[model samples]
Target: MSDRTPNPPSSQSRRLYQMTRGALIILPLSIAVVPWGILAGSLAVEAGLFDFQAQAVSALVFAGSVQLVGMGLIKAGATLSTLLLTTLFLTSRHLLYSATMRTRISHLPLHQRLLLGFLLTDELFAVSSHQTRKEFDFWYAFGAGFSFYLVWQLASLSGIVLGQSIPDLDQYGLDFAVAATFIAIVLPSVKKLSVLVTVIIALLLSVLFSVQGIEGGIILSSLIAMTIGYAISIVRKEPL
Candidate 1:
């Protein structure tokens, strides 16, 4: 075992210097995400929030699915606890994302690490994992994540203003954007039956609990699904 860090190849360094690589890598997904952000903003506004509220949630939450779910819950006037639980559940996948990134990013300064954590989204994760790079550059990830973050905020702002003016943006079918984006994320990772089972179980449990009008159903379902998946992994000595 050696304490010294291995140097990345010169080609990897050259790839890092290619300023447009990260942007190019993220462009295709950004189109999907922008529509989803707009949908979230429009939905939030239609749910009776102030324009600032729509914009604030987009800027602060930054997780598209969680924002959409939170907007729905808010429209229903769900309890604060229910809202919290659902938001937590929606963002629970980030725990795994953060854990996976830790080995690559732990050497960074605390502030930089925090920024990356804040900017971590499904699209950014997909772009990062899909790209084949010999070494991880924080800037490369930052470029991809930052572009996504900026585009989403702008799209949300656009929708907020449009919702105020039109009040009929729902006909545009923007709701499909986030769901489509999710499929794009999962399709790449379903290389194993266990992984598929985990997804099915989570969805099934959530629906079952929702049908029963169970408070915190999303969280309960997600937690149980994760637990079952973990047990399966341990039994098989393989990751789901």
Candidate 2:
């Protein structure tokens, strides 16, 4: 018997492996979003939206933070323009996410890219971006993103079912899962000094903005931190 190295996996097998790995690797983060999804649905119901309306928001918006904040603005009787602007501000981060993956995904067909854009979320961006750094795989990214979307839909449905029966579900602090999940995703990627500084600044600004009762503070802080981080990188790259 000859002892020989095994042949490399076929392209088809490699795609299947990455897709399966993507789905499985994203399970923990997908689970982490369950509570956030539930909260979004419950909050929508609590804000005087019909059950179908809540479900529609979850289905169409597909963004937990935007849905939650939009519901709050609705409850507060915000103007239509205010609602639209707030939503745009909250979801603008997705533009950055898309830009980060543009080089990798540019070759995909328009329909597939649209599907990916629709499925993209904070958690999916975190997981898929991490995976992309190791090896680029469209099937893997699609699998991870689609799985998370399914879990989110089911979780939101459960919330809608319970929203009427359980009063003040939001007061239970289940929303903490959102922050915890983001922390888990972020801490692992803060390898450089610039990244660490960005994280710290974002955290501090978030808390300060919250205490000051500023709307959209979280997104504002994120934008500021990212800008500063980019500047730091540029400066580091320049010759003294």
Candidate 3:
């Protein structure tokens, strides 16, 4: 036998490895989020927010969909109460994300849990959920989330600065990049029949409700889709 024994990786090195792995795994989606972040910042500026205020919204709110909707509401002269209620409704989806992740993160300390909650974006959720429980690590999640956060901040700043110069930035349809990226990410994981069926039905329902001009139609469709998906999974005795 050889006399030399290999040294184990140090804690710091291990943490760095996990963090780097997470960030790399999330890089594609993070890149997709850049245009969405820029759109949010530009919309904020167009809605009459100062550059600093627009950046503040991005840094503080950090929810792309909500920030977009909130800016639309602001442009429409929505009341404060209406904006607040809409924000609450839009963000309610995070509750589901939290519940789904609770089992994985329950053992973490309070501060870590809080930080995780704060950093939990839809993209991060999708990335983390794809990992098996055995592969999940807090540092991994943090690396992914923090990197996305930094990207969003920089993207938003770019938009704020450039928005003033661009005559019609929204006309370029930048949001399509965000949608396309999410579709690519989600499609790979829809290997299960139940998931496939649920996604189809959800798409149909969302389109039908939106076409009908139903209030909160997208949210309603999501709730119904989740319920149906759960029932189908139970009936089929398959994991979802």
Compare the candidates by lDDT and give the number of the best one. Answer: 3
Which lDDT values do the candidates have, in the order given? 0.76, 0.81, 0.84
State the lDDT of candidate 2 residue by residue for 43-96, as single tens digits. Answer: 889989999999999899999888988999999999999999988888888888
Report the lDDT of model 1 for residue 48: 92
TM-score of each: 0.66, 0.77, 0.81
Question: Model 3 — TM-score against the truth?
Answer: 0.81
- The 10 consecutive residues of candidate 2 with the worst lDDT sum are 1-10
Local accuracy of candidate 3 as per-residue lDDT tens digits, 56-78: 99999999889999999999999
Tally clashes: model 1: 0
User: Which number leads on TM-score?
Assistant: 3
Q: Positional deviation of 233 in candidate 3, in angstroms?
A: 3.0
For residues 87-144, could you state the per-residue lDDT of candidate 1 as single tens digits? 8877877887777777777789998788888988877776676443345667788888
Worst 10 residues of 1 by lDDT: 1-10
